[model samples]
Target: MVHSSDVCQCESFIRYEKTFGVTHFYSIEGVPRTGPTNVTILNITKHSALVKWTEIAAEDRLGFLQGYRISYTDSSRKKSPAVTLNASVTSYHLTGLKEKTTYRVQISGFTNAGEGPLTLSQPFSTPKYDKGELEGFVIGVCFSMTLILVFAPLTCCLVIKR
Candidate 1:
């Protein structure tokens, strides 16, 4: 008879033969396991990045994924808090962001199994506003055009009367 401790570490079976008996042993290993799959990010904007990932593996006995953790750093090297999202949710909007600032973002999925690798997004900048002087210049030009149009005809009429 083959003993449990007699099994080879290489997973090879050991067979013992005797004059009137034979013993056989089978070695098996656990199935290979995989974590989350098809993880991706989308709908990226100046203030937020949306993340999408496939369901956990069928063999995965881990509980439902709690949420995603989103982290970011601004151009000035300022770090922001980790943004959390629900397991059922695949999208979120980050608001109150500054305009014309560059931001770098990363995301990862979390569950009882563990946290996944952080997926990074391209650096993006928020939309910038028009210069105040430029806007004032446009307004002034419009006002001058309106005044000329209003008085041009009156001036011509007075000249003809004289």
Candidate 2:
């Protein structure tokens, strides 16, 4: 005879019989649990962004988390390709992007089974470029001052010699 409490924790559920004066235990399957949750974008910049999130659940401790998927849309409302990352990777760098462009980013956590829902960020724009006209004026003023400094001393020396 097999007692109920005698069942092993390794076995989800056990079944036993005494038809042949002997008992046999069989393991049953268990339901799979949900993956991680609460994904969010932490920060963004001109050429890259930083994403942060928390892991809420896992199917099993022995199971491996696959990665995350990052999706984004540009100012033109065109969606970009999905970027895949490792499970342990909470943040990522998105490079080679135009300056002063608006973007919407979302993050989704994933495991071997499936991916969690996407967490999106508010509409954000990259840092604006330096103003060209203002920069040019500043450069012109500096150049004029440098030329004056170069000629002023020679002009004074010539006046003294005369």
Candidate 3:
């Protein structure tokens, strides 16, 4: 036999068996009842990004939080394992990403209860790496080297190294 009751919309279950004559009870305990909010991406780079999110509501969270879990997928459709972090942390840095590719990300808050609903999905793209000043320097050096190679031989023929 099984008996169920609803308290504050939370479910409680009781089970009993006639043959074995045993009873068991299960119910929710102190834990976070809702998911975190306001997940955002910041400080994007060619191979990494910083993610931030709001904390769970105070009342909904019983006392201490376990942590958070983050999941991400890239243009290649490869899924990443949920990254876990301490409860005190709100920002996380994701690394090892392909340049100029968009990654889809989702986050969820967890506590003693379990993982809550995932946040609304968000997509962010890594920008291409820039070698601005280095590129210009290389071009200038090449031009100077070419000029030396051309002028040095002509000058050498006129004013012999003898």
Q: What is the TM-score of each candidate against the true structure?
A: 0.49, 0.53, 0.63
lDDT tens digits, residue span 132-153, model 2: 6558988999999999999999
- Separately for all candidates shown, the number of backbone clashes (residues 3 or more apart, or on different chains) is 0, 0, 0
Question: Model 1 segments beyond 4 Å from truth?
Answer: 1-63, 130-162
What is the Å distance of residue 82 in model 2 from its true position? 0.9
lDDT at residue 80 of model 2 (Cα atoms) = 86
lDDT of 1 by residue, 1-162 (tens): 122333343434335422354443323222213333555545545445454555445343133456666677888989889888766665556665676787776666666556766664546665554346568988999999999999999999999999
**Model 2 misplaced regions, further than 4 Å:** 1-45, 56-64, 130-162
**TM-score head-to-head 2 vs 3, winner:** 3
Model 2 compared with the native: what TM-score?
A: 0.53
- Candidate 1, residue 63: Cα displacement in angstroms equals 5.6
Q: For model 1, what is the C-alpha lDDT against the true structure? A: 0.59
**Candidate that beats the other on lDDT, 2 or 3, i.e. the better one:** 3
Preferred candidate (lDDT higher): 1 or 3: 3
